[model samples]
Target: MRVSRLSVVVAAVVSAVVVVVGSEGAAVAGAGGAAAGGGGHEVDLAFHGDVTLRAGVVRVRFVPRNHGPSDLADATVRLRWSLPLVGVRRLPVGCLRSGGGGVLCRTGALEAGSLGEPVEIAARVAGRPAEVRVRIGTEWSGGAVDRNPRNNEQSVLALDTGDVYYF
Candidate 1:
Protein backbone atom coordinates (compact mmCIF):
# COMPACT_ATOMS: atom_id res chain seq x y z
CA MET A 1 0.00 0.00 0.00
CA ARG A 2 2.77 2.40 0.90
CA VAL A 3 4.54 1.82 -2.43
CA SER A 4 1.27 2.21 -4.28
CA ARG A 5 0.54 5.54 -2.55
CA LEU A 6 4.04 6.84 -3.31
CA SER A 7 3.65 5.93 -6.99
CA VAL A 8 0.27 7.64 -7.11
CA VAL A 9 1.70 10.79 -5.57
CA VAL A 10 4.60 10.90 -8.04
CA ALA A 11 2.25 10.37 -10.95
CA ALA A 12 -0.01 13.15 -9.78
CA VAL A 13 2.94 15.59 -9.45
CA VAL A 14 4.24 14.71 -12.90
CA SER A 15 0.77 15.07 -14.39
CA ALA A 16 0.40 18.51 -12.89
CA VAL A 17 3.80 19.60 -14.24
CA VAL A 18 2.97 18.27 -17.67
CA VAL A 19 -0.37 20.05 -17.68
CA VAL A 20 1.20 23.36 -16.62
CA VAL A 21 3.95 23.10 -19.20
CA GLY A 22 1.52 22.09 -21.90
CA SER A 23 -0.79 25.02 -21.15
CA GLU A 24 2.14 27.48 -21.25
CA GLY A 25 3.28 26.07 -24.57
CA ALA A 26 -0.22 26.30 -25.91
CA ALA A 27 -0.50 29.93 -24.81
CA VAL A 28 2.74 30.80 -26.58
CA ALA A 29 1.55 29.01 -29.69
CA GLY A 30 -1.71 30.91 -29.60
CA ALA A 31 0.10 34.20 -29.32
CA GLY A 32 2.31 33.28 -32.25
CA GLY A 33 -0.74 32.35 -34.27
CA ALA A 34 -2.41 35.66 -33.54
CA ALA A 35 0.71 37.49 -34.57
CA ALA A 36 0.92 35.53 -37.79
CA GLY A 37 -2.61 36.57 -38.65
CA GLY A 38 -3.06 39.97 -40.33
CA GLY A 39 -3.10 42.73 -37.73
CA GLY A 40 -3.57 46.39 -38.56
CA HIS A 41 -0.46 48.46 -38.11
CA GLU A 42 -0.52 51.69 -36.11
CA VAL A 43 0.90 54.91 -37.48
CA ASP A 44 1.62 58.13 -35.62
CA LEU A 45 1.42 61.59 -37.18
CA ALA A 46 2.98 64.40 -35.22
CA PHE A 47 3.79 68.04 -35.86
CA HIS A 48 7.46 68.68 -35.19
CA GLY A 49 6.72 72.11 -33.74
CA ASP A 50 4.58 75.19 -34.03
CA VAL A 51 4.39 76.85 -37.45
CA THR A 52 6.75 79.78 -37.78
CA LEU A 53 6.37 82.72 -40.16
CA ARG A 54 9.48 84.78 -40.73
CA ALA A 55 10.39 87.16 -43.49
CA GLY A 56 7.12 86.26 -45.27
CA VAL A 57 7.99 82.55 -45.42
CA VAL A 58 6.02 79.94 -43.51
CA ARG A 59 7.89 76.91 -42.21
CA VAL A 60 6.10 73.72 -41.13
CA ARG A 61 7.24 70.24 -40.22
CA PHE A 62 5.48 66.91 -39.78
CA VAL A 63 6.57 63.59 -38.31
CA PRO A 64 5.03 60.36 -39.55
CA ARG A 65 5.70 56.89 -38.19
CA ASN A 66 4.87 53.48 -39.61
CA HIS A 67 4.48 51.27 -36.55
CA GLY A 68 5.06 48.28 -38.84
CA PRO A 69 2.75 46.11 -40.96
CA SER A 70 2.38 48.75 -43.68
CA ASP A 71 3.95 51.92 -45.00
CA LEU A 72 2.20 55.25 -45.49
CA ALA A 73 1.90 56.40 -49.10
CA ASP A 74 0.45 59.26 -51.07
CA ALA A 75 0.51 61.49 -48.00
CA THR A 76 -0.32 65.06 -48.93
CA VAL A 77 -0.29 68.30 -46.86
CA ARG A 78 -2.38 71.41 -47.69
CA LEU A 79 -1.86 74.91 -46.31
CA ARG A 80 -4.60 77.56 -46.37
CA TRP A 81 -4.50 81.19 -45.41
CA SER A 82 -7.56 83.38 -44.85
CA LEU A 83 -7.86 86.76 -46.53
CA PRO A 84 -10.34 89.53 -45.71
CA LEU A 85 -12.49 89.98 -48.85
CA VAL A 86 -10.54 87.91 -51.37
CA GLY A 87 -11.43 84.68 -49.49
CA VAL A 88 -9.16 81.71 -48.76
CA ARG A 89 -6.31 80.83 -51.08
CA ARG A 90 -5.03 77.29 -51.41
CA LEU A 91 -1.29 77.33 -51.06
CA PRO A 92 0.80 74.86 -52.97
CA VAL A 93 0.94 71.45 -51.35
CA GLY A 94 4.44 70.17 -50.66
CA CYS A 95 5.47 66.53 -50.74
CA LEU A 96 7.62 65.34 -47.89
CA ARG A 97 9.78 62.22 -47.58
CA SER A 98 10.19 60.35 -44.34
CA GLY A 99 13.77 60.73 -43.20
CA GLY A 100 15.28 58.70 -40.38
CA GLY A 101 13.55 61.21 -38.10
CA GLY A 102 10.33 62.49 -39.72
CA VAL A 103 8.77 64.40 -42.65
CA LEU A 104 9.38 68.11 -43.15
CA CYS A 105 7.40 70.70 -45.20
CA ARG A 106 8.14 74.36 -45.82
CA THR A 107 5.73 76.78 -47.46
CA GLY A 108 6.56 79.62 -49.80
CA ALA A 109 5.68 83.20 -48.94
CA LEU A 110 2.25 83.58 -47.29
CA GLU A 111 1.31 85.75 -50.23
CA ALA A 112 2.69 85.63 -53.75
CA GLY A 113 3.22 89.36 -54.07
CA SER A 114 3.71 90.18 -50.37
CA LEU A 115 3.74 88.62 -46.93
CA GLY A 116 0.26 88.68 -45.40
CA GLU A 117 -0.29 87.60 -41.84
CA PRO A 118 -2.03 84.25 -41.75
CA VAL A 119 -5.02 83.89 -39.45
CA GLU A 120 -5.18 80.09 -39.54
CA ILE A 121 -3.25 77.07 -40.83
CA ALA A 122 -4.16 73.43 -41.34
CA ALA A 123 -2.55 70.11 -42.24
CA ARG A 124 -4.19 67.25 -44.05
CA VAL A 125 -3.06 63.63 -44.40
CA ALA A 126 -4.47 61.85 -47.35
CA GLY A 127 -7.84 63.65 -47.60
CA ARG A 128 -8.39 64.21 -43.89
CA PRO A 129 -8.04 67.73 -42.57
CA ALA A 130 -6.57 69.03 -39.32
CA GLU A 131 -6.32 72.78 -38.82
CA VAL A 132 -5.03 75.22 -36.23
CA ARG A 133 -4.98 78.98 -35.73
CA VAL A 134 -1.57 80.36 -36.57
CA ARG A 135 -0.03 83.65 -35.40
CA ILE A 136 1.47 85.24 -38.49
CA GLY A 137 3.95 88.03 -38.21
CA THR A 138 7.25 89.30 -39.61
CA GLU A 139 10.61 89.64 -37.90
CA TRP A 140 10.28 93.39 -37.88
CA SER A 141 7.81 94.43 -35.21
CA GLY A 142 5.63 96.94 -37.05
CA GLY A 143 2.54 96.05 -34.95
CA ALA A 144 0.20 93.15 -34.21
CA VAL A 145 -1.96 92.57 -37.30
CA ASP A 146 -5.27 90.72 -37.13
CA ARG A 147 -5.87 89.05 -40.47
CA ASN A 148 -8.81 86.93 -39.38
CA PRO A 149 -11.38 89.34 -37.99
CA ARG A 150 -14.63 87.36 -37.85
CA ASN A 151 -12.79 84.33 -36.47
CA ASN A 152 -14.01 82.61 -39.66
CA GLU A 153 -10.39 81.75 -40.27
CA GLN A 154 -11.49 78.14 -40.32
CA SER A 155 -11.26 77.52 -44.06
CA VAL A 156 -11.08 74.48 -46.34
CA LEU A 157 -7.74 74.60 -48.13
CA ALA A 158 -6.57 72.49 -51.05
CA LEU A 159 -3.22 71.47 -52.46
CA ASP A 160 -2.02 72.19 -55.96
CA THR A 161 -2.06 69.33 -58.46
CA GLY A 162 0.96 66.99 -58.85
CA ASP A 163 1.84 67.21 -55.15
CA VAL A 164 1.70 63.94 -53.25
CA TYR A 165 3.53 61.69 -50.81
CA TYR A 166 5.62 58.60 -51.52
CA PHE A 167 6.58 55.96 -48.98
Candidate 2:
Protein backbone atom coordinates (compact mmCIF):
# COMPACT_ATOMS: atom_id res chain seq x y z
CA MET A 1 0.00 0.00 0.00
CA ARG A 2 1.15 3.57 -0.71
CA VAL A 3 0.87 6.09 2.11
CA SER A 4 0.87 9.89 1.72
CA ARG A 5 3.25 12.12 3.76
CA LEU A 6 0.25 13.78 5.49
CA SER A 7 -1.12 10.41 6.58
CA VAL A 8 2.25 9.39 8.06
CA VAL A 9 2.46 12.64 10.04
CA VAL A 10 -1.09 12.19 11.33
CA ALA A 11 -0.29 8.69 12.55
CA ALA A 12 2.76 9.92 14.49
CA VAL A 13 0.79 12.67 16.13
CA VAL A 14 -1.92 10.28 17.26
CA SER A 15 0.63 7.88 18.74
CA ALA A 16 2.29 10.68 20.74
CA VAL A 17 -1.06 11.90 22.05
CA VAL A 18 -2.01 8.41 23.17
CA VAL A 19 1.24 7.94 25.04
CA VAL A 20 0.91 11.25 26.84
CA VAL A 21 -2.69 10.63 27.87
CA GLY A 22 -1.94 7.11 29.06
CA SER A 23 0.96 8.21 31.24
CA GLU A 24 -1.10 10.98 32.77
CA GLY A 25 -3.87 8.56 33.66
CA ALA A 26 -1.43 6.16 35.25
CA ALA A 27 0.09 8.89 37.36
CA VAL A 28 -3.32 9.93 38.61
CA ALA A 29 -4.28 6.38 39.43
CA GLY A 30 -1.09 5.79 41.35
CA ALA A 31 -1.57 8.92 43.43
CA GLY A 32 -5.16 8.02 44.22
CA GLY A 33 -4.26 4.51 45.22
CA ALA A 34 -1.56 5.68 47.55
CA ALA A 35 -3.88 8.20 49.16
CA ALA A 36 -6.47 5.55 49.78
CA GLY A 37 -3.87 3.40 51.55
CA GLY A 38 -4.58 0.52 49.18
CA GLY A 39 -1.19 -1.07 49.90
CA GLY A 40 -1.72 -1.01 53.69
CA HIS A 41 0.42 2.02 54.38
CA GLU A 42 -1.19 2.74 57.72
CA VAL A 43 0.38 5.25 60.11
CA ASP A 44 -0.78 7.02 63.20
CA LEU A 45 0.45 10.53 63.96
CA ALA A 46 -0.10 11.96 67.41
CA PHE A 47 0.12 15.65 68.24
CA HIS A 48 1.27 16.71 71.67
CA GLY A 49 2.09 20.28 72.62
CA ASP A 50 1.80 23.16 75.00
CA VAL A 51 1.18 26.86 74.47
CA THR A 52 1.98 29.90 76.54
CA LEU A 53 0.78 33.46 76.03
CA ARG A 54 2.31 36.33 77.90
CA ALA A 55 2.39 40.04 77.14
CA GLY A 56 1.14 39.63 73.57
CA VAL A 57 3.82 37.06 72.81
CA VAL A 58 2.86 33.46 72.11
CA ARG A 59 5.21 30.55 72.43
CA VAL A 60 4.55 27.01 71.36
CA ARG A 61 6.42 23.73 71.70
CA PHE A 62 5.17 20.62 69.98
CA VAL A 63 6.20 17.09 69.12
CA PRO A 64 4.74 14.80 66.48
CA ARG A 65 4.93 11.15 67.43
CA ASN A 66 4.38 8.29 65.06
CA HIS A 67 2.92 5.00 66.26
CA GLY A 68 2.66 2.87 63.20
CA PRO A 69 3.61 -0.20 61.27
CA SER A 70 4.78 1.87 58.29
CA ASP A 71 7.22 4.73 58.20
CA LEU A 72 6.15 8.18 57.16
CA ALA A 73 8.24 9.87 54.46
CA ASP A 74 6.93 13.32 55.23
CA ALA A 75 4.03 15.13 56.85
CA THR A 76 2.66 18.58 57.54
CA VAL A 77 1.25 19.89 60.80
CA ARG A 78 -1.04 22.93 60.75
CA LEU A 79 -1.60 25.43 63.54
CA ARG A 80 -4.19 28.16 63.55
CA TRP A 81 -4.48 30.87 66.15
CA SER A 82 -7.60 32.74 67.13
CA LEU A 83 -5.86 36.10 66.83
CA PRO A 84 -3.88 37.43 63.90
CA LEU A 85 -0.14 37.17 64.14
CA VAL A 86 1.82 40.39 63.89
CA GLY A 87 5.38 39.12 63.66
CA VAL A 88 6.87 35.65 63.60
CA ARG A 89 10.48 35.92 64.69
CA ARG A 90 11.28 32.32 65.41
CA LEU A 91 10.39 28.93 63.97
CA PRO A 92 11.82 25.43 63.92
CA VAL A 93 14.02 24.16 61.09
CA GLY A 94 11.21 22.88 58.84
CA CYS A 95 8.46 25.29 59.88
CA LEU A 96 7.14 28.16 57.76
CA ARG A 97 4.73 30.98 57.94
CA SER A 98 1.40 30.11 56.43
CA GLY A 99 -1.74 32.29 56.30
CA GLY A 100 -2.41 35.30 58.50
CA GLY A 101 -3.09 33.33 61.65
CA GLY A 102 -1.68 29.99 60.65
CA VAL A 103 1.63 28.16 60.42
CA LEU A 104 2.68 24.95 58.69
CA CYS A 105 5.54 22.75 59.83
CA ARG A 106 7.09 19.75 58.18
CA THR A 107 7.67 16.54 60.08
CA GLY A 108 10.55 15.03 58.19
CA ALA A 109 10.70 11.27 57.74
CA LEU A 110 9.28 9.86 60.96
CA GLU A 111 10.13 6.23 61.51
CA ALA A 112 7.70 3.77 63.01
CA GLY A 113 7.44 4.01 66.82
CA SER A 114 9.55 7.14 66.81
CA LEU A 115 9.19 10.78 67.69
CA GLY A 116 9.90 13.53 65.23
CA GLU A 117 12.10 16.48 66.04
CA PRO A 118 10.58 18.81 68.55
CA VAL A 119 9.53 22.21 67.18
CA GLU A 120 9.27 25.55 68.93
CA ILE A 121 7.76 28.75 67.57
CA ALA A 122 7.52 32.26 68.93
CA ALA A 123 5.35 35.02 67.49
CA ARG A 124 3.72 38.25 68.48
CA VAL A 125 -0.01 38.66 68.28
CA ALA A 126 -1.74 41.63 66.67
CA GLY A 127 -3.17 42.89 69.96
CA ARG A 128 -3.86 41.84 73.49
CA PRO A 129 -6.70 39.40 73.59
CA ALA A 130 -8.32 37.91 76.69
CA GLU A 131 -7.73 34.40 75.49
CA VAL A 132 -6.47 32.66 72.39
CA ARG A 133 -7.76 29.45 70.92
CA VAL A 134 -5.11 27.39 69.23
CA ARG A 135 -5.97 24.52 66.97
CA ILE A 136 -3.41 21.96 65.91
CA GLY A 137 -3.93 19.08 63.51
CA THR A 138 -2.28 16.99 60.85
CA GLU A 139 -2.62 18.78 57.54
CA TRP A 140 -0.98 16.00 55.52
CA SER A 141 -0.13 12.47 56.57
CA GLY A 142 2.13 11.54 53.66
CA GLY A 143 -0.62 9.48 52.01
CA ALA A 144 -0.89 7.17 55.03
CA VAL A 145 -4.15 6.22 56.64
CA ASP A 146 -4.43 7.15 60.32
CA ARG A 147 -7.01 5.01 62.06
CA ASN A 148 -7.00 6.98 65.30
CA PRO A 149 -7.07 10.67 64.48
CA ARG A 150 -8.29 11.86 67.84
CA ASN A 151 -4.84 12.16 69.31
CA ASN A 152 -3.57 14.00 66.26
CA GLU A 153 -5.94 16.94 66.64
CA GLN A 154 -6.27 19.29 69.61
CA SER A 155 -7.69 22.64 70.63
CA VAL A 156 -6.25 24.63 73.48
CA LEU A 157 -7.44 27.84 75.02
CA ALA A 158 -4.59 29.91 76.37
CA LEU A 159 -5.23 32.98 78.44
CA ASP A 160 -3.05 36.08 78.64
CA THR A 161 -2.24 35.22 82.23
CA GLY A 162 1.08 33.73 81.23
CA ASP A 163 0.28 30.15 82.11
CA VAL A 164 1.25 27.12 80.09
CA TYR A 165 -1.74 25.43 78.49
CA TYR A 166 -1.32 21.82 77.53
CA PHE A 167 -3.14 20.25 74.61
lDDT of 1: 0.32
Models 1 onward score TM values of 0.24, 0.76
Candidate 2: how large is its RMSD?
A: 9.4
Tens digits of per-residue lDDT for model 1, 1-167 = 25688898999999999999999977655554425442222222212223533322233433322222233232223333332112212433453333221232332222212222222233333222232223222121112122322221122222332232211
Model 1 CA deviation exceeding 4 Å by range: 1-42, 67-69, 83-167
The clash count for each model shown is: 0, 0
State model 2's lDDT: 0.87
Candidate 2 per-residue lDDT over residues 1-78, each given as its tens digit? 999999999999999999999999777556645466564477889988899999888888899999987788999999
lDDT of each: 0.32, 0.87
